[model samples]
Target: MSDFASAAMLRVLVQGMRELGLDPGDAPPGDGEARVQLGLKQGLVQRAVLQGGLACLPLLGRGLRRLAHEPTHQALVAAHSASDLLARWQRLERYVHSRHRCVVEHCDDTQACVRHVTVTGQGAPTAAEDFVVAGVLAALLESIGLRRVSLSFGEQGLFPASDPQGLAQAAAAGASALWQFHWQGRPARGSAPVPGPAAWAQGADPAWAEPVRRAYLHLAADLARPWGLPVLAGAMGLSTRSLQRQLAAQGLSYSRLLAEARCRVAAWRLLYTGDPVAEVGFLSGFSDQPHFTRELQKRVGMPPAAYRQAFAARPVPGR
Candidate 1:
């Protein structure tokens, strides 16, 4: 699990390959739970299955053509806008406990800047894995009736990628395991409210290190529950000392994870709910508004209100 991907993701890559008459041999288990994770150490041999999945533009398209039929594909196609689609994507990551995660750092009418990353305190995902994920995402957009969707990976460039070839070229262009996913995906359909962070753990670390993952999930379950270390530990069926030791092994503190969970809840409300900022703070377990503002400011590099305004600036699909 720590080094592998979900069975669903691997199926896309493997099935996509088979669709193009390519053989993806012997995909490995992610965490002994039947996940076909790409690579933990990122060794070349470990990537054989992932690499053989798709090689070029035409092959990539033919390989991934089955994406539209998958159960996940059906759910993603229901997304009313690009933001809603990604919100759904983030939610799915939690359910599958994926090692890698994607986050939209910025967006507008014609472009969305995303960051491909691993969960906190985990090893980074390889570039090849990132490329395959990018290919799948592009195909997903196409399924949603979106056209002219192009993607480019870089730290600074916001240029267009006219075809899948450009995305493949940029995947091998850098050794950096983590890079920006600057893609063109305009939001579509009419607006609809996204589910809250309770159902969708957006902007929070969902995997890596079992204790931390569980702690974040518990915290996100109910931010305003007046939870403390003893309470959380008790709920997880561990003594306080034992729980503390587990968290220490991961270099995390209970309060820190709680704060992060709160931040995620606040972000979801800001984006999808028309709730007042004060109300958001209260529901996120902040007894004080100033502390909520300060904590969220540190994590997102902006105040809650402004961060909402900046990241939610996308246009309607057809207009």
Candidate 2:
């Protein structure tokens, strides 16, 4: 039976294909020797790239490479325990899969760990798709300084045992894969503390805090659209009054949550993206440039430009 990839994974694959200048429509078949060209031609291979989103894996790896240097990304990886790091990683995975169907599982011993991911409701994956998945996994492990990483497809033994070319060969055989990663020496003491649910809730009750936060994250990027209390309440399947009462129980209000969400997104963009302050403001749902600047200053204690400049000037560690 063929395995399938989730839409979230497919989206990332599509983005990567666009970055690599590959045409998803021209991908080859996924069987026999023809599978060797799976990355290049159209068929199940192409469908996997277009529908499963494996093409975005490479680009996501590249993005992670860059983000590893960003303070926020760095802090996330600086978790004290393997479980903590995995939890944080799971949160990221959930965010990416918000609009799709996928299952991700992580298992960690003290020195070694495995990540098992599968996309439901799809046929078996193509060689090209598996290759991308392996590459993305390798990239993520490398970004976090994991060493001696190995991958195995079911009971087929270590895949891509020696080099990258082997990945295609192994995937040609059609089997599910598991990633194995090892740590060197003592695990480095995390430079940042692992954040609790409270960190995300900002003093709200943990029960409904994550749902409220997730709602904001899902909507934050579309600043030009209307996302008032009624809209958000509807999305959560609650009446406006019910939602309000729930937030009140947690000592939060819809407006405050919205502002906090905008501020969080604005701060990140200000630090990482090269977008102009005004553009960032608009993208973060502010009424105008001045309002964006004012709110940012009020929340972050610095104007957007200054915040960006300050972070930019700080020498990136391990650069």
Candidate 3:
């Protein structure tokens, strides 16, 4: 059991590989509870499976934006403050792997949060696994609207005040690693409203949903550009029609998914970045200024400039 990971985690890796136009023949067979056993080496699982996902993140464009919109992941981000989001993120790990434990702490003065994660019932940790954990944590924090998020394995004199060299050795020996996350000014209201746990549990199928959602995220950054179903299907190793059928089964379509991705990215840029509204629109894959403004008004209920002005002026928490 120490060598085994949950099917959900494996599925994310498989999906990522497919999105990258690579063969996912490495994944174990079957689905559901009976499909729990993933017959692969732990090191391979980390390197090929987990690291593979991270490698394809850039191609997915605005990967965090896609993740932030995921129904289940969104539920975790539905928090009042940075502290609240961190707590929810820890709880969300249970849905990923049963053998892992994530613990988070905040400094009283600096308000910097450190998450120490330990994997019990597992063999020695590899650098690949460490990278995956760090990548996932960074994405989640960004999705919850945190800025200046940084991940480090062992930094000297950081939280818990341990020797950096010893911490690195311990990490290689399968001990916990520390992830440090911070925000500028103070915590502010997250971009989207958090959904209840029940909403997360409903219609949640980790096997299919995880990968398909990942595919959408990978393409999120280029939403303003023209993307055809065939292109997306090719990336996912499916015919255009097959892709359509699969998404339909999950109550999604390529157009809807792309729109949502653009909306989320535009909203994040308007709220967090100083980039011009036109640039945000262009980056979000809008064809032109009018198209961008119209869609943004429709989805966000205001033009980009207005949205930024209204929200950006709000008081930062603990300021």
Maximum-TM-score candidate:
1
**Clashing residue pairs in candidate 1 (N, C-alpha, C atoms within 3 angstroms):** 1-30, 1-31, 4-37, 5-37, 16-63
State in Å the error of residue 183, model 1.
7.6
lDDT of 3 by residue, 1-319 (tens): 3333434344444554555565656556223221144344243344443444434322222233434433334444544456655555454444234345456666432244464444664543354454445455555555556666554444522221224355446545654455565444344454665322122222233555765675565456334224578877886788888888878888888887777666776676566555445445545555545676789889779887788889864532210
Clashing pairs for model 3 are 60-218, 78-194, 223-285, 224-284, 224-285, 224-286
TM-score preference between candidates 1 and 3, better one: 1
Top-lDDT structure, candidate number:
1
Task: Give the local distance difference test score of model 2.
Answer: 0.48
Candidate 3's C-alpha runs over 4 A off are 1-64, 95-97, 107-125, 156-176, 185-190, 194-319
lDDT to native, each model: 0.57, 0.48, 0.51
Tens digits of lDDT, candidate 2, 72-186: 3443455434444454444433322322121335546433334344444443444554455555554444445555544454443332243333444555555434445444432
- Tell me each candidate's TM-score: 0.46, 0.40, 0.42
- Residue 230 displacement in candidate 3 (angstroms): 52
Off by over 4 Å in 2: 1-67, 70-76, 98-106, 110-120, 123-125, 154-169, 186-319
Error of 2 at 278 (Å): 16
